[model samples]
Target chain A: MIKLSELHLGILAALGGIVLLFASANFAPLPGQAYGAGTMPRLIGWCAILLGCFMVATSLKHLPEMAKPHLADWVRKPRLAFAALACLAVIVFYILFAETLGFLPTSFLGLLALMLVLRTKWPTAILASLATTLAVYYAFSRLLMVPLPRTEFLSFLG
Target chain B: MLIFEQAAALVFDPYVLGVILASAIFGMLVGAIPGLTATMATALLVPMTFFMDPVPAIAAIVTATAMAIFAGDIPAALLRMPGTPSSAAYVDDAYKMTQSGRGDEALGAALVFSAIGGLFGSIVLMTLAPALAEVALRFSSEEYFWLVLLGLSCAVFVTPSSPTRGLISLLFGLFVATIGMENPSGEPRFSFGNLELMAGIQFIPAMIGLFAISEILRTVTATIPRQKIPRSDGHGIFKTQWKNLKKYPVQTVRGNITGTALGILPGAGADIAAWISYAISKRFSKTPEKFGTGHVEGLVEAGASNNSAVSGAWIPALVFGIPGDSITAIVIGVLYIKGINPGPTIFINDPQTVYAIFMVFILANLIMLPLGWLAIRGARPMLSIPPSTLMPMILIFCIVGAFAIANSTAGIVMMLIFGIIGFFMEENDIPIAPAILGMVLGPMLEQNFITSMIKADGDIFRFFERPIAGGLGVFTILIWTLPLVMLLLRRRKQARLAT
Candidate 1:
């Protein structure tokens, strides 16, 4: 991930506010009233624009330092960066496959993979993954009746 | 008397008691771990609470937060690593006491004083909230608009950060709240044609992402070496507390007052309360030189203050539906989800439930005593759990918790997106509390604003026509402009000096 300086963030905020203002411009007002759904968004957009300008003005004094954007420290370290990406990957993996392959397999695989990436031993990772997957399965699926995706093979377990 | 009995019956049920016990353990576990906050604990508990009845659901949260705040002291005393931000205030005093073989006393002061302070705040909540609700019941849309604005203003201004950054966060949250078709005109503002987006951003999933997932990312990517947990003599966890209580009665009471007061203020919570109480203790102490070097004086005061602040934060949340801190911000969301709309009307409409909540507060504080002691005794094993192992487990919980909220992949997707946003916000020194506050209060602010505007036929000055609304509006505007005024005055003074 990139570490954005205040100037960059301010610029982004200003652009975002401008986009909001244009998007809300077409929202029809309530019948016979001066405002509608667009009113609050417009107000927020204006505030964001003003705030962005204020931030840019205040940050300009440190322009030499503030204009430069860099990578976060974690992004510079391969191992840690991998771990961070692996965490996001696990979530994405779960989202894509939880419904298809079921919560048990997807969660177990995701947890074990992330654990292994984080340097947990294979045995500990496997056992912890299996145990946590089952525990969560029962806690949410059975006790709480959340109807989490289930595998035919794990039907009896459910 | 009947209402009190009904409230007691609601609280003492086997199920309610069981939920309290379970959440007490859960709170202790989460709070005793470094980097997991009481707010995180509350966020994690929300999904489970979503399954239970309103009373037990609320009981679980009430018990968990009270326990989490106290449990934070355990790691602070033993490892010089505060388990939560609230414990950061007196970490030096607590750790020095441990190093000097007074660890038991330090932990005991934290546990006992925390419970005492919680009880004091609960009593204050019981006595004060209903009385204030009477006044709140008379408020109208104009009054609500200013009140919500005042709360949002406090969230941006009172927090220890650049107000500009806080306002940016607040604006982002308000914008997020505008995504659904829940607005007055029933028009989809930013749904982008997605079915789920039309329902608005899911509060629980967003919160889980903001607090839990971002915390996991930060913890996993950090380069700080883990410190060895210090061995402490855990015997007599409560033995010295009595002596300390007697010795520092004034400090204890003062801490309770300060914490409760701060807690009642919008956006300020236990963390700030602890820091302020510790400062006050030192400011008034004759032996201030001993503050950072194994002194228990500051611990007694700040420990009490943090827990008291937890209970004090509920004041505005219960009475006005304005959250006093991030925890209550989440609670307000839960209450609305449960169809128990908070505000002064709740006292009149659901008096029994209101009293039951009051009862839960007292019960939660009392139960913190035994649970806090057990946490202190078992701190070594709990602290030994590696982040590499724990982070994955927590991630799975966050994933499932987010998914379970609405039983859709969209919730998990939202969590992931917000997780990255939260991480970026923290990296940029933007405070998350105001954002959470803004998200929770955004719709209400807009609804009240539009209602007042329509009622006044776009006459903006009529917002101040009602005396109460006028007072609140003026106060909110003053809070907004005071800092700018101060900056201008200081600049003028500087110019004169330079000339």
Candidate 2:
């Protein structure tokens, strides 16, 4: 876990730098109109800088009250962490495969993989995963008219 | 009379009826699923609605969402799991009601009261929105600027524990809003050398990240060891009493009215509406202690208030083209994409469309009553599903939902970012609401402020000089100061008493 003081200091420094970057950019001539792209960013940059300063001050003065991040706890629960990572992997695979494998097969694969990871019984997992995949496929395709990718494999099956 | 006839025609349409029924059922299913919020459900549906008639689309979407919100109570009451944040308040009470074999009664009361509240909210919206818009038409950009400021200020209470952090979050959101090309000019700002950034952060993906993925991460982190409470095969699973409803009519009406009024207020959404109504009811109750311990009145009030919020949310969406909550924001986006302008001029330009949407509300609420009844009757069977099964199913929804939005691997990546950030934030009791409010309102504030500043020729004082802007500034100041004043007064009183 990062110390609150250190976190505050780092966050503020980063915010200040980001603000300065915006301020250094060529600014618009008018307040609302854009002579350049930098105007609104500058305003937001200043607000961030000010808030960062306040956060730094508050953290310094009330260190006990400052919040500490709990990355360690997450690290301790390796299974939970793995589950979360598995979730991300499943989603990434779904998106990648949606175009190639198409919606149905890909969705079913993603669900089945996730179900296994979640420790669902194999029989129920296969059944429910298939039902959900088919239901969503029908809803999106026939009812909502969303154009899901049609792979050659899927077309051949049809 | 013309509007009435138009509305009546909408009511009589069979396709319109079908749309409402289907949408509401879908919404309920969406809401009942853990981590699948009304906003996510609405966003997923919003784009599809583009192909449909605006009237039926709006009706179906609204019906689905409203029922979905109520359906959240189902999980809360039965499983001690809140499907939506708005249902969070009554979760304890409703769950307790279930444990005591009154779960069916609690669900019944919530369903009936929510129906009543939705009707009341629509009434308030029908009366108040047009009048407000008529008044709002008089507002120049100066007033518009103030109104936005006032809205941001009201949002301050949305995360009361950390006001400074809230303001910082808002500023960050505003900064994100600036990333895209300038609205007034074609010039790009904050693109940081990326074309995708030039379009700015898409609200839907950002929302999906914040609400859906954030929740999944939080749940994974705080994995509660499932308690094995004996499953009661209680018989009165769908029993609700008109007698009980009549007994608590005052509570239901009060909750509905308060929820609607709060809903109409910019920046106040269903979560606040439910909280505020619950508090008011508790305050006025003769036995306040009865709250949080399965009080039927508390359940009735919370349900009604959240229901009213759905209607109340529409006032801003329909009249001003501003969404009061995430769901309404998606609806406003839908209207924008559909080329249906929703401002004061919209009423005059498309009265029939406006009436059609309103008529949908009337029909949606009516249909929700029967649909709600059937769903509640069928809920106990749903409770039989083991958490193990649910965890996988929800995980699938979360995965597909995150991916389907932009088809970007970046969205899934962003979901991971927000989920981690959100889990940590919740762990520290730092509150997730401010971060979300920051994400939601940040860009709007920037755009309005930049636009106002441009109009004022860099004169910062001009922001304070306009009547509406000045008024909002003063109100913001008052809101910011009054809490400090109360704290100081309390400290002083404590000192004097000790002396």
Q: Number of the top candidate by lDDT?
A: 1
Can you write out model 1's per-residue Cα lDDT over B1-499, one digit (the tens) per residue?
9998998999999999999999999899768755457887888789888898888988999999999899888877875556777886687788888877788889999999999999999998889865643454567899878867765775666344477787888888889888899999999878899999999998768876876677788878986665444655555778888899899999999999888876876666787688667866876898977876889999999999999999999988998898878999999999999999998899888889989999999999998888887888787455467888878987897788777767899999999999999888877777665676677778888898999999999999999999999998998797778778999999999999999
TM-scores of chain B, in order: 0.65, 0.72
Q: Ten consecutive residues with minimal summed lDDT in candidate 1 chain B? A: B226-235
Task: Quote each prediction's TM-score.
Answer: 0.75, 0.75
User: Candidate 2, residues B271-361: lDDT per residue as tens digits?
Assistant: 7677666756665788777777878887788799998988988887788887767788888877877789888788889888887777777
lDDT of each: 0.84, 0.68
Question: How much of the real interface does each model capture, measured as fnat?
Answer: 0.78, 0.43
Cα lDDT for residue B61, candidate 2: 81
Clashing pairs in 1: none
Model 1, A38-103: lDDT tens per residue?
A: 999999888888888877998999999998888877777899989999999999999999888999
Question: TM-scores of the first chain across all predictions?
Answer: 0.95, 0.77
